[model samples]
Target: MKPEAKNETQEMHRVEMTIGTILRWGVIVAAAIMIVGLLFYLVDGSLGVASNYHVQNFHQLLQGLIAGKPYAIMMVGIFALILTPVLRVVVSIYSFYREHDRLYVIITSLVLLILLTSFVLGIEFQL
Candidate 1:
């Protein structure tokens, strides 16, 4: 094996190690975001109902929420639902940047756009 070939192998190994570290940390960040958000709900007080107007109930909020995946706690669930995806995004972006992956960045962005469009569109269709 040529000296230059050995050098290349070492470089590849280093790159792989870096990528693995980034991925592991990314998963950790996402999980932490979810867990922290959930804890907030458990420790916080409940959202007080201003007044229960039997004649004028806002089922829209309930319908929109129920149509989607049920959250564990209303506040924490909402935060966790939003935060986890966002944390994943931060992780993906961070990993892509660390790996210097232009193509992956483009693909991630496209997928996010599609997912967001679908989520928004879903709400509209629910009504």
Candidate 2:
């Protein structure tokens, strides 16, 4: 009933709420990553066997990964696209740990990475 006690309770409640929010978003992100992985698997299957099978442009945006085509290089370069965001998240996680903050790090990193990646990759490289 004391003012100090009420403040403590409010602070604990806020921390709990923030933790719950982070957990929810983490789960959603994990699910999305899983779905995308599954799609990649399906696309891989459509690539077919290596010895005699062929994958046509009907299913491929570029000739094929091994064809050493420019589009293939570009497509492979897309993997590098993840570097900035991954680095940002790593830095933000350390920042959060040092600051004793919650997973706002993830949100902040995502936003920072998106803006940076858009400017660097989308505009500069046209990727």
Candidate 3:
């Protein structure tokens, strides 16, 4: 292949590697956070305390998180787990844009839009 082609291929590979790293680390970190929360619950024996699931808004969620609530921490980990793939979609959009692959950029952008819309609906409808 031409030098330019080789360089482009290398760049794409690097981008793929970055996406893989993001997913791997996202899951690992989220899992670790969840495990810590679980251990805290086990040691503290706070299962009787009701989980604050009706987190009316982001501010409430942050307040719960700041208060060191186990369920809130676990939910944050789960949210991170759920968002990892959406992050991949975002990175994919950037990679495609870098490659000047307009079609894929548009496709990935649409995927991101759908993901955001669903998240919004989930928060609004308490799904």
Q: Find the candidate with the highest TM-score and give its number.
A: 3
TM-score of each: 0.40, 0.37, 0.91
What is the per-residue lDDT of model 2 for residues 3-69, given as tens digits with 9 covering 90 to 100?
9889767866665566555555555565554455446546655423355543333235354445543
Clashes of 3: 0
Candidate 3 lDDT at 26 equals 94
Colliding residue pairs in candidate 1: none
- Estimate every model's Cα lDDT from 0 to 1: 0.54, 0.53, 0.85
- The TM-score, computed over Cα atoms with residue i paired to residue i, of candidate 1 is 0.40
| Superposition error at 56 for model 2 (Å) | 32
Give me the displacement of residue 51 in model 3, in angstroms: 5.9
Which stretches in model 2 have alpha-carbon errors above 4 Å?
Answer: 46-127
Candidate that beats the other on lDDT, 1 or 3, i.e. the better one:
3
User: Candidate 1 residues 1-127, lDDT tens each?
Assistant: 9998897678667756765666566566656655654554456543233333121223544553444312322433444445455556655755666567899888887777777788678667755
Winner of 2 and 3 under TM-score: 3
Q: Find the 10 residues in a row with the least total lDDT in model 3.
A: 47-56
Q: Between candidates 2 and 3, name the one with more favorable lDDT.
A: 3
RMSD of each: 8.7, 10.4, 1.8
The residue pairs found clashing in candidate 3 are none
